[model samples]
Target chain A: MRTLNPLYPTCPIRNIINRMSDKWSLLILSTLNQNNIMRYKELNAAIPDISQKMLSSTLKRLEEDKLINRKMYAEIPPRVEYSLTKTGKEFMPAVDMMVNWALEHFEEIVS
Target chain B: MRTLNPLYPTCPIRNIINRMSDKWSLLILSTLNQNNIMRYKELNAAIPDISQKMLSSTLKRLEEDKLINRKMYAEIPPRVEYSLTKTGKEFMPAVDMMVNWALEHFEEIVS
Candidate 1:
């Protein structure tokens, strides 16, 4: 049996994987991967049917884990944008594998 | 961005993977993969420090997800043993990959 090393004080990779598998995070990261930065609302709108609350929470956790960067440009309307951190981009292959695996096998998994 | 298919109206593979990463499931399955079947307390004891409730809940979830089979032998002490289901075994390669990735990359991911 293998033991997990707790990351930082409280973070665990299991927790990280859970956050990565969050219904919104995969979409959000995949969306942001194309563009360096994306406005919060723009990303949300692009995700198609994600709840605002879910998007907010998922982004917050991803940022906390340093997987995504949340930058606020305090302009006229307080613009906030999200982009993948180096760590987040590194996991792109894994996440892409996950998505592709999902596409290929979810039907088989479901049936 | 890739879209996730909501599996079976509720059971998403994301959910399944989350459960698979349940801190106990991987160890539990890895333990059982060796012996094919084991009693609840025996598996718990083999896990070193797992709580009874946690083992129970994890096994219950695995059973509910059809990843495992629980056979209760109507003995004087009410013997019960757990074994992996067919679908569960198919996921062995993926789970092994996860464990290897965790063992190999978790340190890098942490620091």
Candidate 2:
């Protein structure tokens, strides 16, 4: 009898891609990519369709993943903003590739 | 009175990433990236945790998305091999970045 290699079975590539590949995550990342930095209301306005719950949860996940940074201001009203981290910036090229691929193959794919 | 830009609201980046970011899809793509070309059994062996049903469905989605190419050889047992298409190959650098990011930040994330 032979045993399977436990190390080979755990897939980090799948894990990371699964985390980052959600609809809102990619959209939020792309939105941030374009705007560089945006406030919560700004993000909500920029991507009109996302619900507040979805946006908040996705932002939280991305922040926890260290791909995006969240900063809160001490103003009386409390200003909060989000931006890509250095790692997130490094991830933009990959995002660009995905966007370019999608744009080029859009018709073929959606048809 | 104002109207929203419908064009701006439809997110292709999100659509494409959502399609590609599933667990098995990422693993299969990474396996194909490493092996370049592999038969059904080879892929199954390469990614151990994936159930046969999950693998088959992921392969179909990837094929439909045109990210992978499936070549069938008529033999007594019938042989099918899979490889990344040009687009899929182009997508590898992004995969590399994801893997690199995972390696760099795994502990921070897992803890």
Candidate 3:
């Protein structure tokens, strides 16, 4: 196995994991994974506990990271929607594995 | 898919991910995954950038989460070693998948 240097700023594993490891990113990603597409308000409503500020910033970060795309429509009030990018969609299998593991081990670890 | 509440303290996925999501824990876990068993100093040496205090605490947290085991020998100088617990070992396949994904997508995500 190749050596992993967690402190290396550009290390792929570090960079990827850092992005996913944040408190809200995975949840948001998984939320989009299930919903396919969501409006900003729908996402905020779905993740009830996240503040509007956090949700906005996390969405922006995901967009900047190329994990999710934000689309705006030219309409009366304007419609903005979020969905996982192809790369983001590709990443979900790993996240699914993690979610399954967490479900299986939740009691053992959290207790 | 089940709904995930990121803010829920007892939510299994959140709990497990939070534990693995820290700056050092996954790196330490992956290091141990590769090494099988290592002494405290060996771990410290392997990850050149981690501070002694942070290493000690992260190891403790992993142990507390039942991810790793600490063994001490009653010798003249005393010997201490660390290795993954059964649960920790079980969790690594998921980590491996994430690592593989990171390697494959590094350029696209990090650029």
Candidate 4:
């Protein structure tokens, strides 16, 4: 009967939050927010079952969006470290909210 | 060095939140939370640019997940309305957290 309206430029709030509230982005932020910085491998371990492809892709997205900064070290195997930018640190409040929500609402899903 | 640990059964927390925190789901919940119920056409008007396929798909997902209840009316041209379930209302606090986060961090995206 009517058209579906997506939040684009004018309603970028939903658009941007959609970016941060995704599968990998949520978990990736959970990992980085607790540490000053983490190399790629350590971060992967922090998240038990993330794929390399998804991790790399998610990280790249956060990097592009300025949520996280990636620093590369010249090494035999190439070392890289990831840290949340100042802008990213602000997002942690939302992340904390999610964690608390998860713990609080965990029972709802089971029942 | 390691595989992506996508949150599944053990980590169903992130998995479930991922389902709730999506493009249409977020906006749709935002709409329904403000109102007890809304007809299909009425809900469409609330969101400015959502597509028919996505709205239908997103609503269907939320319905299946039990976040919202869909009621069909025996009326001309077939009438339907959407409402959030008990579990759905429980999700609103987390949604509020997101809204607050967005308002606080809106400048980061453009800066």
| TM-scores of all predicted structures | 0.63, 0.82, 0.89, 0.80
lDDT of 2 by residue, A1-111 (tens): 112235653356654556777778888998998898899999999988899999999999899778899999999899999999987887777777767767776656554
Q: Report the lDDT tens digits of candidate 3 across residue range B14-108.
A: 66776676658888999999999999999998887889999999999899888999999999799999999998998888888878877888777
Ranking by lDDT: 3, 2, 4, 1
Question: What is model 4's DockQ versus the real complex?
Answer: 0.28
Model 2 residue pairs with clashes: none
How do these models rank on DockQ, best leading?
3, 2, 4, 1
Q: Whole-model Cα lDDT per candidate?
A: 0.67, 0.78, 0.83, 0.77
For residues B2-110, could you state the per-residue lDDT of candidate 2 as single tens digits? 1223655345665565678766788899889889889999999987888999999999989888899999998978989999999788777777777776777665554
Candidate 1 to truth, TM: 0.63
Better of 1 and 2 by lDDT: 2
Highest lDDT: give the candidate number.
Answer: 3
> Candidate 1 lDDT, tens digit per residue, B1-111?
223346334334344344455557766877787789899878978876677888889898777666789999989989998999886676666555544544454555445
Q: Could you give candidate 3's per-residue lDDT for residues A41-67 as a string of tens digits? A: 999988887899999999998987788
| DockQ of structure 3 | 0.44
The C-alpha stretches of model 3 lying farther than 4 A from their native spots are A1-10, B1-10
Name the better of 2 and 3 by lDDT. 3
Q: How many backbone clashes does candidate 3 have?
A: 0
